[model samples]
Target: MDDKMHELEIRIQKLTQVHATDRVRQLISLLIKDIGEKTDASTIRIPCPLTTTDLARMAGTSRETVSHVLQKYKASGKLMIESKIITITDPAFFMR
Candidate 1:
């Protein structure tokens, strides 16, 4: 019975992890879609350029995580940061 309970706990952990991943993916998709639509012909757009606090709130993530990801993206040149403003540098960057 203890082994069965342990197995169930592991399964529940796996399921919760998957659900969290799925939610993050869905959120990223929504953000990209919204950004795409807001882009101009210049291939750069700033849609809801938010502070780390606000972005974290929108994505239900930690501000530190948001800052880290945004900085990573900016470093990769897939996105850009001007002061606190996040701009999509390559509007077609995510089409793949």
Candidate 2:
């Protein structure tokens, strides 16, 4: 019984991680479809009005994780964030 409980715990942890990833993916898709404008075939610009906390709620993830992901996108030059605006320099990056 103890072993079974441990196995179940591990499975739950894995599933939680997967859920978080899925949430982020959903957030990205929503951002793209809801606000993204095509500047060209490969680039999109989004005027994001939502705050990090708002995004977190929308994504069903922690605010820190959302901030971290946004920073990563900024670092990779795939996106830019300024105040309440977000520009997606590489739409292909999110499609993948």
Candidate 3:
């Protein structure tokens, strides 16, 4: 019972931390939770084939927003997207 309450508390905290205006953070959290796997010390790979629409659905946002955030991450060297594969360049960056 205590453990379940703690888990619920953590979940509530995560949901509370995500604001409607912070779509990028929401998307990042969704991606990391859904498909991210630690490949090495500094890298995480999202091997599942996912489209912008899929990401939008998972993140509860629009396809355009997902595309925009992905582009920004690509430009910032935070993530790479190629043929549906997503590789997070710096896993620690998203852990926060």
Candidate 4:
């Protein structure tokens, strides 16, 4: 990988691990939490919502995989989809 990609990977790994890097760990956590609260819940059926396409991009997974997860989530009564808007029916479902 290029230096920039390598650097980003190292940063991500470090953040995922001990989170000792103050700038990356705490700052990113707060920002992400805020985003989760404000993001539209209809897109992916979760309160931390994302459109399938956007999610595909973010997770480095295919749109099909995202759709599959949504379908499974709906089937398990963890989510509700209406007019392409997904509502998180159970907030603690993922914890299980």
Candidate 5:
């Protein structure tokens, strides 16, 4: 199916990037993209439905790594997590 092919292609791309870049950066980039796709508004702050563990699985990394990176982002005013819902304050942060 077309959807399956798209998923396969994305997986292939992730595999390639996984080796070429830092996992934390890759994970954050993916998170931003996912959030962007899910949100309907132009607002920068949007609640993310995915959890840290889910993000870790998608990024092919450990939950601890995702947690650590998220903490840094929170400290930097890029995002915050409460009740397992993440809110991206600065969507552009992941781009850098």
Candidate 6:
């Protein structure tokens, strides 16, 4: 029952973030929650058993849009994608 309630709370939070935030932030938040795991205090690792199409479907956006936002993050040094894995260097950027 507690697990179910926690899952429901997460679903509500996701809905709130989706409706309240911009596309980029929405995608970022989803990526962190769905694909990422915190390896330490400040770093989040998203291992690549996932694809942009999956992310687009989850984010209710296009594959092209997902790619674009990912590229922007890559360029900004906030995210790193290599060897089919993604690492978020600054998790706090998305927390805001």
Top lDDT model: 3
lDDT of 2 by residue, 1-96 (tens): 999899667644543566665566556655787678887877777765777788788667898988888887789897877775777887766766
CA lDDT for candidate 5:
0.66
For candidate 1, write residues 1-96 as lDDT tens digits: 999899667644543464433433344444665564455664555455568777667556677776777776678887776766555666555433
After superposition, which runs of candidate 5 have C-alpha atoms over 4 Å from their true positions?
A: 1-16, 19-25, 35-48
For each candidate, what is the lDDT?
A: 0.59, 0.72, 0.74, 0.50, 0.66, 0.72
The sequence of per-residue lDDT tens digits that candidate 5 reaches over residues 1-96 is 999899879855864576422566665666566555444353243355677778777777788877888888789887767787766667665666
Winning model by TM-score = 3
**lDDT (Cα, tens digit) per residue for candidate 3, span 43-67:** 7888788898887775666788778
Please identify model 2 stretches exceeding 4 Å from their true place. Answer: 1-22
Candidate with more favorable, higher TM-score: 4 or 6: 6
**Root-mean-square deviation of candidate 6:** 3.5
- Best to worst by TM-score, what's the order? 3, 2, 6, 5, 1, 4
Provide the TM-score for each candidate, comma-separated.
0.55, 0.69, 0.72, 0.47, 0.62, 0.67
Between prediction 3 and prediction 6, which has the larger lDDT? Answer: 3
Worst 10 residues of 4 by lDDT: 19-28
Candidate 3, residue 66: lDDT: 77
For model 1, state the Cα shift of residue 5 in Å.
38
**Which stretch of 10 consecutive residues in model 3 shows the poorest summed lDDT?**
19-28
Candidate 6, 1-96: lDDT as tens digits: 999899868755665565422555656666687778988888899776557777667666777877888888889888787765778888878767
> Which residue pairs overlap in candidate 3's backbone?
none
Q: Where is model 5 poorest over a 10-residue stretch in terms of lDDT?
A: 37-46
Evaluate residue 90 in candidate 2 and report its C-alpha lDDT on the 0 to 100 scale.
77
